[model samples]
Target: MNKHETYAWFRVVFIGTACAWLCWRLFFADATGGADIWDRNRETMSIVSYAFVFAMAVFTRPGKGVVADERDRAISAFAAKSALVALSLVVLVSATIIGTEGHADLLTARSNGWFEHYLFACVMFGWWVESAICVFHHWRDRR
Candidate 1:
């Protein structure tokens, strides 16, 4: 298939695998004896997922003579801008919530481990949003 289709499929696979892994770790895995599998294996799972996605990306090849043109560049720029704006909004809202609800100083909020987890989640969400937008653009343009 074409590069755009391949990239979209890669994103799909990445997201699907990530969600499946999360579900398995959080729900399906035995949590007996108060052992938190997610807490203990978070880094390892993330590394494996990232490696798998990167391998998929590295192995995928574009169709012969396929090259990105002005339209593709425009779509990519648009997707990036959208992702940035969404991420900015997420950070702003999160900061506001922590500052108001937690009754803590901004510095404390920034430094809190819980806040860091939220930020990490937001970053991942932003990436998925960007990928979805790019995939949508590709699909729409193909139609």
Candidate 2:
């Protein structure tokens, strides 16, 4: 596999693992100091996650002999556009649900506490989608 494909897989796996861990901490695990603790430090958690992702992107260089060709750039642009579309759809749906008070089951947050966290999670999911798309195209290219 090429560096791009490797990096894309890394991102998808990392984000999936991080999200799963967060979900476990939120619902199943009896985290120290309670789950409400994360509510108080949501911003910090978000910042840390964003920083980690950015750091990974920065550090994941193309290596000494690797070079980005037109196809790579095209794939990246397409993936980015697809991810943005996914994000916009998510935001729109979320806003509609929130605005209309349409679905009680959908809003499981305690006192609407999880809305901000939900948006952050959606953004991360969007990133994951982008990486997944990149990986898919790369694999398709191989086949």
Candidate 3:
């Protein structure tokens, strides 16, 4: 596979694994009395995520040959449009749920940084969605 296809697959895998682990740790692990590694090492994990993004960018950097062609750009554009739609749905659903909780609770959640965390999740979800779309399109093109 070409670099773009390889990167798309890698992005999907990495983001999917990370998001799944995070969701489990955040929502289920505590109830099951499982490990609290995520809570204890959140800052470290954030740094690691940043490093991973940097590494991916470096991996996709332009070489002597052409970096991205028209097809790659088209795939990315389509993926991005779909990702935006996914992100909008996530936000709308989250907002609707939060809105049902009333203004006082909303203020409290905001003060507790719940809103910030929600925004972070939204952004990550957007990237994951985009990567997944890219992977599907790339595979379809190959077929």
Candidate 4:
């Protein structure tokens, strides 16, 4: 494959890995009883994510070859569209779930669970949704 495809592959792998980590943390944050590993886990994931994005920003589409050829643009466009829809669904569901309890002492109620859980869930869910969209884009483009 060419540099563009290589870049895309790396990008997907990086984000996919990060998303996997986020999902793991979300589910197991309590299993570890919120130990130092939890903090380290989040920090490492954040650093890796930022580093990957920075590398992509510096290295991606580094040519006059349409900045992003037709396929790349198409894949990204489709991915973004799907991500938007998926994010909207997440927000709507979160709002619905949150509203169900009517915010009665929201920040204090034990019933509310941790706010970070929802935040992490939404972020990871959005990334996964984008990854799925990108996969669909690749499959469709290939066919």
lDDT of 2 at 24: 63
Scanning candidate 4 in windows of ten residues, the lowest lDDT window is 106-115
Tens digits of per-residue lDDT for model 2 on 70-113? 88889989999999999999889877876775566545434333
Q: Candidate 3: global Cα-lDDT? A: 0.74
Question: What Cα-based lDDT does every candidate model obtain?
Answer: 0.63, 0.75, 0.74, 0.63
Q: Where is model 3 poorest over a 10-residue stretch in terms of lDDT?
A: 30-39
Clashes of each: 0, 0, 0, 0
Better of 1 and 3 by TM-score: 3
RMSD of 2: 3.7
Candidate 4: C-alpha lDDT: 0.63
Best by lDDT: 2
lDDT of 1 by residue, 6-113 (tens): 675677667656655554543355542232433455577568657866765676544456567788778778888988998899889867876674555534423233
Q: How far is candidate 4 from the true structure (C-alpha RMSD, Å)?
A: 4.3
Residue 134 in model 3: lDDT: 88
Candidate 1, residue 86: lDDT? 86
Q: Give every collision pair in model 3.
A: none
Models 1 onward score TM values of: 0.65, 0.76, 0.80, 0.65
Total residue pair clashes for candidate 3: 0
Cα shift from native, residue 20, model 2 (Å): 3.7
